[model samples]
Target: MLSDIRPAIVSTILFTVLLGLVYPLAITGVAKLAFPYQAEGSLVRDSAGHVVGSALLAQPFAKDEYLHPRPSAAGNGYDPTSSGGSNYGPLSADLAKRIKGDAAALRQSTGHVQIPDDAITTSASGLDPDISPQYALLQVDRIAKARGAAADEVRALIQRNIQSPLFGFIGQPRVNVLMTNRALDLALPKGQPKRA
Candidate 1:
């Protein structure tokens, strides 16, 4: 009995240290060294060297000039740390109400009555970094108008910035909201411009 208890205790202690502390530290160290940018949270910076946000998570943009990410059920929209979907089932009345409210608000904000499902629905993780291409395009008119840029020019920029699905078929096509907004800032005419 004594021998059995002693070996069990020793093995448990050894495995805990090896798996819990040592293994995690080793992997983290290797990842930091090999993939510094990603290991550091894949943060994006502006030309002025200001930290904007991480490429991994989406941020909320209420202004019509910026493309908005999917509606987040987290704290305020797009709260990364509080990542989670609303978890409302299809027949849930709360889901219906939220979608209706979102669609109405989007129409009012952009003055574009056509709302995509992506615009009205939240992603499962609540940290989706991309919006459907259609949703991104919906904002082009509003943003172009706000910036006094031609719709065609904004459309071109959106096209240029669009990223295809991983492996060309894994997930749906999406446009990164942060990248699109940053490009908009840079793509608008430098001097006086004509509005469409």
Candidate 2:
């Protein structure tokens, strides 16, 4: 009985220290050294050298001068702690109603006959940082008007920020809303004030 108990306790202590402590620390150290930016949450900063947000997660941008992320259903929108979809199926009337309302509002705002799907729908994670290039382009005129910049200038900014697909074939082209908005602030800082 004593012999068995001694081995069990030794095994428990050894495994606990090795797996619970050492393993996590080792992996974290490696990650930090290899991917420092990502390990630090990919935080984005402004020209003033202040931390604004993360490049990986989505954030709400309600101002007309800024580019907006997708419709988030995560804890009132873009809540990283509660990242998830609304789980509304295609047949869900509530989802349909929301989409219709959003579409109508978008139509009124942009006046584009063909609205992009991403502009109206929420992403699966509800924290998608990227938006389709078309959706970004759609909001160019409104953003330009709000920022007191020319429409072509705003459109060019979006074009510069548009990221190509993974390996040129895997994924769709997307624009990081946060990055583009940051660029907007830098390019047209005259009329648009810095967000607190």
- Highest lDDT model number: 2
Taken over the whole model, the C-alpha lDDT of each candidate is 0.83, 0.90
Model 2 weakest lDDT span, ten residues long: 187-196
Which pairs clash in model 1? none
lDDT of 2 at 97: 97
Compute the lDDT of residue 189 as modeled in candidate 1.
Answer: 46
What would the per-residue lDDT of candidate 2 be over residues 7-66, giving only the tens digit for each residue? Answer: 899999999999999999999999999998898899987667788889989999887888
**TM-score of every prediction relative to native:** 0.88, 0.88
lDDT at 120 for candidate 1? 89
* Candidate 2 stretches greater than 4 Å from native: 1-13, 47-50
Q: Stretches of candidate 1 above 4 Å error?
A: 111-113, 189-196
lDDT, candidate 1, 1-196, per-residue tens? 8889988999999999999999999999999999999998999886666778988888887766778889888766678778898999989999989888888888987778778888889998888889888888888888888777898999999988888989999877888988777777766843544221
